[model samples]
Target: MELKPYRDNVGALLFNGAGLVLVARRADMPDAEGAAGGWQLPQGGVDPGEDLRAAVLRELAEEIGTDRAEIIAEHPEWLTYDFPPELAGRGFRIAQRYRGQRQRWFALRFTGRDADIRLDADSHPEFDAWRWAGIEELPALAVSFKRPIYEVLAQAFGPLARALASAAKSR
Candidate 1:
């Protein structure tokens, strides 16, 4: 079989002041295959010719509600993941043309209050629910294919996550 290219995408790990990362429940989870109704960080495709940083911010606003987050750090390397065989060619708009995603991940500090989030901000919402979760909790909450990425993120951002959590507790 011919090898297919991966989709260029951007992912955000939005952390509150307390260090909990933001996760959203996919509103359009595939009904028959793939992980069923699990939480995931905000991510979307990078538009052709779009700058990576700009794409990250745009994806945050598009997937969540507000772009009230500041970049803390970025993963040093681009991360790629493939969809489960069962999910390949499922016609999902984001994955329809590719084997999976090649993502540039960002670590962002959310500057907005919880009230600032609006699942309905877009005409078609991607998430039905949102919550803040501890860094270690990410891997477990994520779908299987995404777990490895989350694990790497948890490690890559561990220091910042701990500091934020400590600061929040001190307040």
Candidate 2:
């Protein structure tokens, strides 16, 4: 099935105390136009009448296989970015649906153990594989369009991650 680029969407970022962030690899899902190995935080579009926070939780469950995770913080405002023409689907350009996505950033804490991750729980798995990576490493791993957002995320979460690192050292 192909999405007609409705231009309306939402997503979230789940982080953990170890200073490691969860990232997923895109499934080689047909009609999806992006690099397969490219990594990103778990996220999906919001359903009609659904609250954004609920959408974030739903996506987390579907993508990361958990019904709940601790939300440490969230951006007070929404963050948005545009997709380059070449990176966009044909339908996206035809619909001209608001150009790109407007997402509410979330900072989540995973409460479950590593064994809890069920990568194949969904009808369409968003990721083929995943790993915990440094926040600073994300910009380098992300696609060009998402690199700027990674930079923003690094700045937004850098201090907390550092504090966690410092705490671990004192243990």
User: What lDDT does model 2 reach?
Assistant: 0.72
Worst lDDT 10-window in candidate 2 = 1-10
Best of the candidates, TM-score = 1
TM-score of each: 0.91, 0.81
lDDT of 1 by residue, 52-158 (tens): 98999999888888999999889989998987766544556555557788999999999999998888999999888999999889889888989999899888898
Model 2, span 12-111: residue lDDT tens? 5666658678888876523245547578888777778988777888888988788568777787766766666654464444225445676777777777
| Candidate-wise lDDT, in order | 0.87, 0.72
TM-score, cand. 2 vs. native: 0.81
Give the C-alpha miss distance for residue 22 in model 2, angstroms: 0.6
Per-prediction CA RMSD (Å): 2.1, 4.3
Residue pairs in collision within model 1: none
